[model samples]
Every structure is written in C-alpha cells, then in structure tokens.
Target: MSNANKHMPFPELTANEVSNLWSSFLMNSMQQRLLEYFLASTDDSKIKQIIEKILTQSQENINELKEIFDKENLNAPQGFTEKDVRIDGIKIFSDTFILNFCFDLTHLSISTYPIALSECTRNDIREHFQRNIAFTVKIQDEIVELMLSLGVYLKPPQVAIDSEVELADSFMYLNGFFGGSRPLNAAEIANLSRIIHRAQFSKMIFVTFSKLAKTKDLKQHFGKGRDGIEKVLNSLKEVLDKENIPISASGDYLISNVEASPFSDKLMLFFVNTCLGIFCFTMVNQAMTSSLRTDVVSKLGKISDDMKKFYGSGLLLAIKEKWFEQPPQAVDRKV
Candidate 1:
C-alpha cells in the first residue's frame, strides 16, 4: 500500500450512502429503546445476555451515525428515544417472544446490510455496513444456538435428496395453474416457509400492540393488521399444505393480555409502518422472483398487493399522527 493512497482526499457521501446511514440511524435508535425495555422486563439470564449484546451494538451504531451526520452538516433524525418506552411498565411479552424478536431482527439485518454495503461508494459508509453485517451474523448464530437449546427453534421444512440429476424438458415445468403441476422446489419451499414465519411473528406483534394501544383508532389499526396477516398466513399456508409441508405453530400464546402500554403509540406505529411493513414487501418480492411455479407467483403477487394497501393505510395513519419523519431531501434552488 502506498502512503499517497492514504493521503487522497475522501469524496462527499453519495445519496445511497446518506440514505443507508439515515435509515440505519433511525432503526438503531428505535431498537435501542426496545432492547432497553426488553432488558428491564426479561427474567431469563441467557436471553438477558443476548438482549444486552444487541442493545450495546445498537447504541454504538447510533453514536457512529451521529458523528457522520455532524461531519456532513446534516441534522440527525428524531428517531425513537427514552420517551418512546417505559422501562418500568409491566411485561407485555414472554421471554420466548423477546428472544424470537431478537432473532428476527438479526435475520432482517443479515438480509439488508449487504445490499446497503454494495450501494455505498464511500469507504467509511461501506465499513459501517460491513461491521453491521458481520456483527448481526455472529449474533444471529448465537440466537439460533440459544433457541435450539431452549427448544424454541422452528426448523424449516426439509426436502429429500435425489441421487440422479434431471433437467427440465418442457414448458409444463413452469405450469402450476393447470392440473398435474410440478412439486415445489427447494427455493419455493424455503421462501414459503420464510414468509409464513414472518407472518406469524407479525400477527403476534399486532395482537400485542392492539391490546396495548392507548386510543381506539390505534387499536383498530393494529387489529386490522392482525386480521390482514391472518389472511396472508392462510393463503401461504394453503400453498404449503397442498405439498404436505408442516410449519411451526403460531406465537399468539407468547403475548400477554396486559392492557397497559409499555411503549408510546408513536413508537409502536412507526415500527409497524417502517420496519415490519417495508420488510414484508422486500420478502414478498424476493419470493415472487424466485418462484418458478405460476400459481405460487400469482399467490405471492396477491399477497404483495394486499400488503401494499395495509401498509399504505399505516403510513397514512403515521402522517396523520405526525409520527412520520421526513428523510433527507435536496434543497430548493428557487427558494
């Protein structure tokens, strides 16, 4: 390495880099508050340790993002804060639910960070996402190990191996609409299982949030979310059931019936609107692209369309409540 290379001036952050950092800052800040509440309420020592690790990582990411925003002369977003969560509030979720939530968070990070990393032209921004990806992977492994030990891990459906290799010979291979369709492939099975699991989690979240929401309107919003997830789950589950694939049981029992809200309505709504809602679209798109069967793709398309409407409603609610934060925008030259 030449010393001159190190002395080269660094360029300004690109739009992609800023977008990643901004989104990341808001996510970590929200996660930090949620983890704090989880840490306060959790009783299991092992799960507590995991929450601590995640919380520390979230805090560190927020600090680094603050530094970047300051250096770029950009105002940091007013993401979730201490006011968003009441650490002393009664426990709303079982320890198992918290652990599973952590696992899902890591899963999302693993899926998304690489895309963020690839889009960045700046070295510092790339390094930030690189570190995030590495950390989430390690933590995800730990979470899996813990879940397996605790007997809470839900394994995906397994496909039997075939000794002989065969290639598709006819257009009928893609035909899933007519009778005598081909059996589900490994990729199709995996995507279906993943979507099912995500929907299960979302259902339970909506259940809990609905019960704890302060106002009737928010409660109805979350209740509708719960109902929407149920429909998606049924549609996807039917696809798997026709193939005789078994999925894990629902997590509805993991949520408590506590009527008191541990988190502010703003925080809860933002989470559903931004984090879970956006990720649902991403997963559906991935499934739709990977699915070879026409029927499977058609079902996924319908699911995606339903989610768009549901998430659109949530976004509108966020705006109406003033919970939606504006991202970075270009200055108006005319002004």
Candidate 2:
C-alpha cells in the first residue's frame, strides 16, 4: 500500500483528555465541605430527608469513580483548595447563596456526565453513566416542583419547531442513529462534549433552585430534569468512547461567586434556573444535528422541549408568585 494510503493510529493523550480535570478534582473535594455546610444550615424536615438521600448517592458515586480510576491505573488528582472556588460575589452566609452553590455543582455535573459517557467503549459503562444522568435529571425536576409548590415559578423558553413535522422527523432520525455504526471524528466528539457540558451547567442552576424552593413540587420537577439530562449525557459518552475520544478535565467550567446568589424563595430560584436552562438548550439545539447522529439529534430535540416546559412552568409560577415583571413570549408546544 502507498504510504499515504496507510491508516494512521489515533492520537494518544498522556495527560487526562480535558484541561479542567484538575478543576473538577478540586471542585469535588470542595463538595464535601459544601455538604457539611448544608447539613448545618437547614432545619426543615422534608428538605433534610432529601438532602440525606442525595448525600448517600453522592458518596457512592465518588467511591465508584475512585474504583474506576484504580482499575485503569489512573491517578486521581488532588483538587483545588476552597480558596480556589471561594467567591466574594455571592454572599455565602445567605440561604439563597447556599442554594445557588448547590445548583452550580449539580448543573456542572449534568454537563460532565455526558462527556465522560461519550468516552466509554463498553455498554455496561454507558448504561451506568446513563443512570447517573437520569438521577441528576430526577433531582432537578424535583427541585422545580418544590419551588412551584412554594409559589416560585421559572419561565420556560420559546422553542420554534413544527410540532407534527418535528415529531415525525425526530423519531425517524432516531432510528437511523441507532441502526448505524455510531459516527466518530475529532470534531464530532468535541461537539458532543460541548452539548453535555451545556446541559450540566443548566442542571447546576436547577440544583440551586432546589435548595431554595419551599415546596415539594418544584424540587421534584428539577430532579426529574436532572434524570433526563443524565440519560442524554450517558448516551453521548457511549458513542464518543466507541469512537475513541473521551472528554476529560479540559472541558469543565470555572465557577466563582459571580454566578452564585441566594434565592429568597422558590420563585427567585426558578427564575435563575430558567435562564440557565434556556442558555443550555440553545447550545444543545445548535450542536445536535440530523447529519452526524440522527438518533442523538432527535433525542436532544425532544429533551430541549422538555427543558423548555420546565422553564415555562417556572415562569408561570413566578407570575403567580407576583414575581413576573412581564412574561416573555409563550413557548412552542410539542405533542
């Protein structure tokens, strides 16, 4: 064979794939401290029960990650000091601030889960990560529902899709993606990672709302959203890993107090989260295409509407809370 015709080997990364690995390691370290702070601050019984349940889940995930690293001969990096994440912008002492902090972390998780899933080659690993994504979505939906029950509403986004056409096209495209050899290229892998990251940040906003929401319904809505995003992230990860491009530390976000703020009540929290979800949905919508992975695109489009509804519900609740200055244009409804 001609030298030019010879197949080239995939590029090997000596360090972890993403640059933000160190940041993530550090952030996870800080989560323990944050959890401790939350345990001491809230006295509400229902909220306490939910917190405990989540804490257990978080602990298990950490252990599982550590085991994965050990089996792979990978060394986990020591994370950043609290000072690295500490921001003066959001007053840490306020209830709203604490809630916002949790939201940020959860949102980030939503983003990272898919990227990691994209890198895995095995079905078992993909399924495991997908479950994690679902858990996150469930948590986010719960948070939103809880906020709504408390009279806090987050406004949903205005999505523009021909309902009938989109529904039919989406399902048809999804079949194509599942039937084919999942496409893999450096650009495609990067795009998938971007979609996951966008979703994660969006979820962080919902987590923040959960902390501040007064009722069970808003909280439930946010939690459910987390579950859905988690599944998408997991699927993305599976495809990416099969293609041999796993996202690592390089793709994470840098959170400071600027993005942190206390929600005075469920309404305030929903308002913030709605904005975050819209931003994320836009990115997901843009990155998702019928060309590369039709199944993924269709799935993403459906989820985009799901999130939009969450945002819309939050907005309506905000109006009920007497919190709406003026409602944005009504969002497109999907069947």
Candidate 3:
C-alpha cells in the first residue's frame, strides 16, 4: 500500500460530489430516452435540432458519469433500458407537448444545478456541475425564447405594485406561529405562487399517468401522489389567502387521456418521484426563509415530511420492481 496516498486530504469523492454525479447520471439517462422518442416524431426542423443538442449533451454526461463511478469502484446502476421507451411506436404526445416538456425540464435543471455546485468540494466535480449549469442556462434561454415567440408561454399573474419602497419598522414581521405577524414578503409570495403552479402540474401528470398506467399498483401510486400534492397546494394557498395575496393561475389543463401507454409505468412513476424530490428541495429552501412568519414554517415543514414519506413508499416499489437505479456511493471496506 502507498503510505502517501493514504494520507492525501479529501482524496475520495465527498457525499455531495457522489450525489451530484448520481443524480445527473440518472436524469441524463431518462432524458435520453424521452428525447429520442421526441426527435423521432418531431417534424419541425428547429425543434429537432434542439432535441438533438440536448441528447448529445446527455450522452457526454453519461460517459463522464461512468468514468466517475468506475474511478470510485462503484456500480453505476442501469436506470432504464430500451424496454422503457418505444421510440418508433405511436406518437402519444403532441409536438407542442414535447416542446413544453423540454422547456420545463431545462428550467428544472437550471434551478437545481446551483445547489449541487454549491456543495461540491473537488475541483473536477465542481467543474462538471458548473458546465451542467451553463449548458442548461443556454438551453433554457432558447426554450423560453421559442415559447414566447410561439405565443405558448405560460406566465405568472402580475402582482400589484406597492409603487413605493417602505422600510422595516419592527421585527414583528417574523412572528406567526403564536402571535401577530406582518404580511407576506416578496420571497414568500413568490415561493407560494411557484408551489401552486408546480402542484397543478403534478396533479395533471398524475391524472394522465394514472389512466395510462397498465398496472394496478402504479395506478394507485399515481392516484395517491395526485391527492398528496393537491393537499400541499391548498395548505400553502391558505396562508397566502390569509395575507390577502393573490395566487397565480394554475398550469394549462391541456392533457387528454391517451388511453394507451406511450411510456412504461416504471418511467412515469420515476418521473413523478423525481418531481417530488425537486419539490422537497425547493420547499426547504423557501420555507426556511419564510420562517420569520408565524405558522408558515411548521406548515411547510409538515408538507415536506409527508412528501418524503410518500416518495419513500413509491421508491421502495420502484426498487422492488427493479425500476429504481441505485446511486453511486463510497466503497464499503468491511470485507
């Protein structure tokens, strides 16, 4: 054994680095399958070019993630295979639907990549995720421009302006759990509005997937997620309503029953769980800052907890069915 090698500082991948690698790998894999199918059916040359670019980036990431896992002597789990998607099968989603999905997908990546970048300690790891952030920003901007130009962009409702800036008068603004508290801040309002929109999106996803899912177990899981997310949305909206803040409009109710599976049950379930994971990440970030208000912290915390428990159950099912991919971790040396 090399003595100097053993004494190296931070030689192995940190937990944050491992997670960043694992999540990026899994998401890239899933996106690859979806993008391939979209590209096969896309007739518009512009949309096909965008899809191809994303797929190329994903392939580059997949190769790099494999390298990272190999260096760590970890098994890079095979998430979904060709069985999960039928690339030449019936085109289940419309071109518009495909474009909108890509738009949201890139935006989600843009929002979460910074959290991964922040927790990275190794130079190589930081650079990898930083590239991810940059690439996603580029793609997200293009998607937004396309949506806006096509008049298909869904915008948040306009909030009435205060017109004048006001200074903080007291710390009572932070109180809410036990006593009087000031009105919601700009951050809290924005957070709540975002929550509502995402909840609506999740609800629509569940409704469509539940009907399309061929298995009873998967159907039940989708139904429960639909109910759970709706509950969280209403709870958060109550707080905003109490503050007399107007909530933003919900996402479009444009999804119709496909009556057949375009994607496997495994894929849709995993997709739902992925969204729940993002919601948890976002909720903690927003709620901790909103804690200055009374009752808001506790309410949001409970919702996050409930979401974890719900997602945990579905994750177990995915694992049992061999649909969930195990993420990379440090080597166990007990042998």
Candidate 4:
C-alpha cells in the first residue's frame, strides 16, 4: 500500500456502511468468479472485451472491499469459491446468452446500488457507491451499444396513435376493479416491456438450472418455477404481441439445450431469489398503479404475489440447506 493512501484520515464505518460493504463484497466475489467461466467460454472478441472490462472492474472492487474489511478488523466473508464454479464443466450457455446475462446483471445493478447509496453517510462509502454507480452506467451503455451493433438488440416497439386521446372525461382512467379500463400509456407500456423481458430471461435461466441441478428435489423445484414463470411470461407477451410491440431480451435463441451442471444448486437458488425481489419491486412500482388498465394491473399484482410466495419457499429451502447467509442485524434491546 502507498504510504499516502494508507495514512488518510478516515472515520469508523457506520453499521449501515459496514453491512452494505459486506454484502457487496460477497456479491462482487460471486460475479467475478462467474465471469471467469464466461470469459473462458466466449469465442467472440468483442464480447470478450466487454466481459474482461467488467470483470477487471469487479476484481478491483473485490480487492478494495477486502482491504476495508481487513482495516476494520472484520472477518472477510467466505463468499463463493472455486467450488462454487465448476472449472472443467461443459459450457452451459451460448455466447449470446452470456452477453445478455452481463447486460441483465448490469441493468439490475443500476437499480440496486442507488438504494444502498441512499442509506450511506460516510464520505468514503458514499464516494465508493457513487463510483460503482458510474461504472455500472458505463457498462450498461457499452452493452447496449454492442448489442445494437450486433443487430441482436431488442428495442421497445414504437407506439402509434392517430390522435392524442384527450383525457376529456373522468371515465378515461380506471382503478383495478371498475370502469375506465383503458389501453396502456407510454409509461405502462415501457414497464410491461421491462416486466416481460425479465420474465423471459428468468424462464430460460431457471430451465437450464432445473436440468443442471444436482439433487432431484431442487431440480423439480426449479422446473416447477420455470413452468410457473412461463405462464406469467406468456401473459405479459400476450399484452405486447397483441399490440405488436418489440420485446427486448427475448431468450428464444440464446441458451442451448445442454446436459451439464455449470452452477451449484445453492448459487442458482440464490440467483432466483434475488431476481424475484427485483421483479416484485418493479411490478408494484411501475406496473400496478392508479390509471393502468384493470386487467393489466390485476395480472401484475398476481404475479408479484406469486413471486413473494416463491421467495418464501426458496428461503425455507436455503435455510434447510444452510446456504442462506444472514445479514447483519441490530442487537436486540431486550437482550
């Protein structure tokens, strides 16, 4: 360490800062290890460059987080390891799928890191999160640019109407139950695009995980989840395809029907749970609201509820297998 960098005056990290950093360290560790496999499997030079750039940034974040943990006298998280990734395993996803995975994860980070940043108070912590957010935005732009150049990019379909539907009367908008069930607006349409794309990705990813799970029960669970998510995807697609809106991240041509266990059951289950949370949040905040079409609102609400139930079951499974990592919690005042 440089003497100048080592000797900077820094305050003790708040509990929030410490907890956030701990969680990020574990997540970045998992991503970095996953990228190792992806980088090895990709044959395309352009895709390799993008993955390598992202992976390099991931590694730097991992190191910086470890240094903070060490300095704070906190035990570094075990996170994932060589065992978490099957080094000599068969290639599970095609290069196209790999690129989309990167894009999806990066897109997700855009929403997640800012939430963490909101709670941060320390200057160093805030600065670190700001930098992380900036880097993520860059990666997102690069992925989109490359996808567009590759001609595989899924753009949201353009909406066309002969005339502006004047909100001339109170009957134009409707609640979830009664009257004024109107067609989707631009915002609602955009949210549907987001929801549909996520559902499609989840189905394909879980289907692969279902086939690759080491245990029969987990396999069945993943398969069932995949099937259930497929219904939701279809419903979402019906909304879009009926209107002829282009769907982005269509998982149709990406993943191959492979026979290999590329990821551990624990890793795959955790991934499912994390995405479930993101989907639920997106649906409620963006899809289910005042003025959305009655049927669309109900559909989004039902799917969000199903995801919550699925998350609960997954939590139980994770607990039983001792795979769920408990985050830091405040001390009980009663204790």
Candidate 5:
C-alpha cells in the first residue's frame, strides 16, 4: 500500500460505502476468528454446525463485497489479519460473554444497514444494501432467539403485529418518519424547511438513548455515539435552515395501530425496541450530516433529555414487568 494516507485514508465514503467496507471487513474478521475457534473445539457436532453456518454466510458476503469492489473499482482491503482475530482464542458458547459480543456486533451491522442504503448514491448499491439489511436482520433475530433459548438474558423483540399485512404497513409508516423524506430537489429542499425539526426531534431521541444505554458487559457499545450523532444532526439542521426551509421541531416515534407486545414477552420486546432505538438514532445522524443543519443539532441536544427519559422509562417498565416472573414468592426465614 502507498505510504501516502497509509491505512486510514481521508476519502469521504457515502453511508453505503462506509458500511459496505466495514461489514466486509467485519465478516472476514469474524469468519477467521470463528473458524479458528471451531477448529480448536473438541469436534462437537453442535459447535461445528454453528461454525459452518456462520462461515457460509460470511463467505457469501465476502463474495458480494468482491463483486461490489470490482464493479465500483474500489480498492478492497487485503485478507484478514491475525489482529482481526483478537477474539479467536475466545470460546463462543451459548451463554458466554463471547456470544454476547458476537451478537452485539451483528446488531451493529444490521442497525447500520438501512442508514447506509438510505445514504448511498447508486440505485444498484442501495438495492444491494437493502437486501443485505433484511438478511442481517433475520440473522440477528435468529441469533437473539438462540441466545434466549440458552438462558441468556438477551431477548428477541416482540412487536405485536395484528397480521403480517398490518405489521408491514405499520412498520413502513412508522419507520418512514425517521428514514426521512425522499431525496430533496433544490426547489423541494427550499420548501421543506419545517420538516427539519421533525428530523431533529427524531435525532434527539436517538442520541439520548445512545447515551442512556448501559455500557457494561453484554450491552451495545456505541462508542461516543451521542456526540457523533449530535454533530450530524446539527449539520443537517443548519443547512435546511440556511436554505430558508422551515426547520420544524423534532418529531416523536410515529405510533401506529399495531399493538404493543404483552408483558410476558418483555425481554424479547426490549431487544427489538433497543434495536429500533438504535436505528432511529443512526437515521438522525445520517440526515443531520446530509442536511448540514446546526440549529437542528442544537435542538436535538436540548430535547434529547426528554426523549431519553421517555424511552428509558419504557425500557425500565419492560424490565419491571419481567421481574414479575412466576409472581415472586417470599421466602420465610425462621430464626
């Protein structure tokens, strides 16, 4: 590699480019580590099955990345390195910390996929990203469910959809609020000022949740997530306002007729809700960066506390409901 700009270059990546490159790298990194771990296992059938399944998926994604790199004439990084396999020596058991780490990484990839698709320039790339996003989500849900079955506290999200049909529509409309409006024409951009606030408020909820999430073991590690998002939200808010768009205040999560899952499934519900929370946060970050709005960012920071409190309460309530498992019997201690 050329010494100029060395490993980390300053080239600006579209959201798609950034995620594609990162996911490709991560898949390669994960595959290598997983293979090593499996080889070290005592030839257990269950472990082998899990290893083969994940390795197969990684190979598929690797092939896809190669195709994208070749078509785009982008330089793909070299093969995976020893350093990439930092966790190779670690065992990934159903209830172990390594399993949590792997699942968290999967969540990161899935959460960012939609953002990248929304930000990418080319239609083909966007479509590819969208497909990958869906695949990743399915994989994530499966992984979480597996963990839950193993008695890991990590639960699958249970958004109570009436029917698949109803769920589809609810997801579309609700997600759209954060996904942002269609790409703006110059004239349309000029007229869409008020919508900026809606974006800001959405961003506010995202950043606040990012900050509030517990960072200890088995939790999502966003790494300066709040600051990074605020920067992006401010940029978008500023640009929209500069263009005389009526930068509206931040909007709320658009609730639909879709019912909330019952308290019995609180654990799984939290898993899904947390993932959605992260998605909303990322979209806000992307939109803010794309729009270059300072005012929106500022407002986002100001209002994030309220949003955090709102969502935080939801998470706590979910946990509280879980505490009712088997109706807690009081132990009688006779001295």
Candidate 6:
C-alpha cells in the first residue's frame, strides 16, 4: 500500500455502507436462528455439517457487526432471537429442501455483497463484505457438489448456438405478439429459466409458511404470495413452452404436513418481504432489461407491478403489527 493511503484516517460510513451493514446484521441474525433449527433437525451427516459451519459463520458475522455498531454508537437491530424460533418444533422441510434453501441464500449473498462492497469507502466495511462474498461462494460450491452427488441438482436447459455471428437487422426480431418474434436468445432463456426456478422455490416456501402461520392475516398474505408466484411461473413458462424448451420444477412435495409453526410470524414475514421480495424484483428487472422480445419484457413488467403491490401490502401488515424495525436515519434538525 502507498504510504499516504496507508496513513490516511478512515472515513465515516456512508449512508449506503450503513444501510448495507444494518441489513447484513439483521439477515445474518435471522439466518443464525433458522440454521440453528435446521442443524438440530437434519439427520444427514453431510447436510448437518454444512448447516453447522454456516451457523457458526453467521454467529461470527453477528459479533463482528456488533463491534462495528458499537464503534459507531449505533443501536443494533433487534432482528430475530431465540424466542422467534422453536427448536423443538417438528421438522417441516426435508433435508433436500434445507440444502436448497442454503444454496438459494448463496445466490442472494453473491448478488448483494459485491454491490455493497463497491458502495463502501471504509476499508473495514469493504473487507467485511469481501469476506462474506468469498465465504458464501465457497459454501455455494460445497452445496452444489453435495446436491450433484445426491442426484438432486436441477440443471438449466441446454441450447446449441450457431457458429456464425448474427445481428438484429430488423425490428421484426423484437416482435412477440405479432408472431414474427425471433427465437429466444441465450440471455432471455437463462433469465426465464432462473426466474422459473426461483419462483418455484418461493411458491413452496409460501405454501409451507401459510400452513404454519399463526394469524389469519398472515396466512392470507402468504396464500396471496403463493398465488402471485404461480401466476408468474405460468406466464414465464409459456414463453419457454412455445419454443419446446423443457423447464424442470423443483419438488413441492419436499415440505412436510407438520402443522406446528417453527418460526414466529414476524420472522417468516420479514424473510418473505426482504429475501424473496427483493430478490424477485432484482431478477425480474434483470430479465426485463436483458430480454429483446417485447412480449417477454411486457410480461416481466406486469409481474414486477404485481410483486410491488403484494410486497407493499406485506410491509403494511408488518407496520400494523409493529414488527417493522426502523433503520438508522439522519437526525431531524427541525425537532
């Protein structure tokens, strides 16, 4: 490192950095509680080992985040606690579902951590995100290998590309509803496949949560979420179906009929609102931008609008129940 750069004082955390750190702390805390339950319930030794490792890592991350908050004199978020999870509750998801859940989390971390890292100017915060990204990538590889060995991995559709380079020479290539639309390109196919897969997983989660939710309102909210996901899946699947591309559905049978709630309504609602809700929007936005077909873009736009309404309602429910914690904010000088 250069002498001047090394000797320079650390800057105060930017608003972006503070927001990322705050969100990370809450996410990791919730994951820790969820993982603790998973670790207690899993019978597979391999899956148990992975769960243990991740749980430990989450605890460590929480401690580190606490130190950061302490240094800044920021009040730590309440996040989730032992009271939010019932470790003695009956196992609701299969071992495979647990593994896939962890795998899905890696996708969320990989996508967000780099963006957070880029937004940070402080050396300490940058290193924190960098470390998390690396750890999540490593765990993701391990989960994939295990899934492959167990014959549970669902691969995306394979397509053969032409050897010759081609360019879009006419506006007709973008047409979809008019029936002159060009064949789905690699990017469009990928985005469609990813969205389908994610939606399937999310639908299963919604179903499981709905069955276990304590309140009538929460159950209704989850039911609506499940319906919304199915609507999106059908629309996206039709685009792939027209091309005769096969899309594999994840196992909805993985959830057990255990009626007992393992997690508090607050935790489940927060998970849906932040993890699934934010990731869904991100994926749909990416698909919209990458897709050249007008029909595909239009479909995504409609889905995005639907998700905004559904998730917005969830936020209102959280607020009404006094479950939504306020994030750090600028001081009000007028006060």
Which candidate ranks first by lDDT, i.e. highest? 6
Number of the top TM-score candidate: 6
Ranking by lDDT: 6, 1, 4, 3, 2, 5
Number of clashing pairs, model 6? 0
Reference-based TM-score of each model: 0.95, 0.41, 0.82, 0.89, 0.38, 0.96
In the predicted model 6, the residue pairs found to clash are none
Local error of candidate 3 at residue 119 (angstroms): 3.9
The Cα local distance difference test for each model comes to: 0.88, 0.52, 0.76, 0.77, 0.45, 0.90
Number of the candidate with higher lDDT, 2 or 4: 4
Q: lDDT per residue, candidate 3, 1-335, as tens digits?
A: 25664466546888877887888888888888878888997777777887998989988989988997898887786867788887876666666667777876785687678888999987667888888889998988887787677666766535665768888787776677655676676666767777776776667777778888998988998899888888988898888777777765543445545556767888777777775467555755676666557577777778778887888888898888887666654468886
TM-score of 5: 0.38
Candidate 1: clashing pairs of residues: none
Residue lDDT tens for model 5, 131-204: 66776677667666655665654222222233333232333322222445232333334323423333343343
How displaced is residue 23 in candidate 4, in Å? 2.3
| Predicted candidate 2 versus true structure: per-residue lDDT over 61-164, tens digit per residue | 55665564565455655432333232233433344334434555566567766776676544445555687678778877665565456443333322233344
Candidate 1: what lDDT? 0.88
lDDT of 1 at 116: 94
**Which of the two candidates, 2 or 6, achieves a greater lDDT against the reference?**
6
**3-77 in candidate 6: lDDT tens per residue?**
677778777889998999999998898899889889888889999988988898899999999999998888889
Answer with 4 or 6, whichever has the higher lDDT. 6
- Give model 2's TM-score versus the native structure: 0.41
Worst 10 residues of 2 by lDDT: 249-258
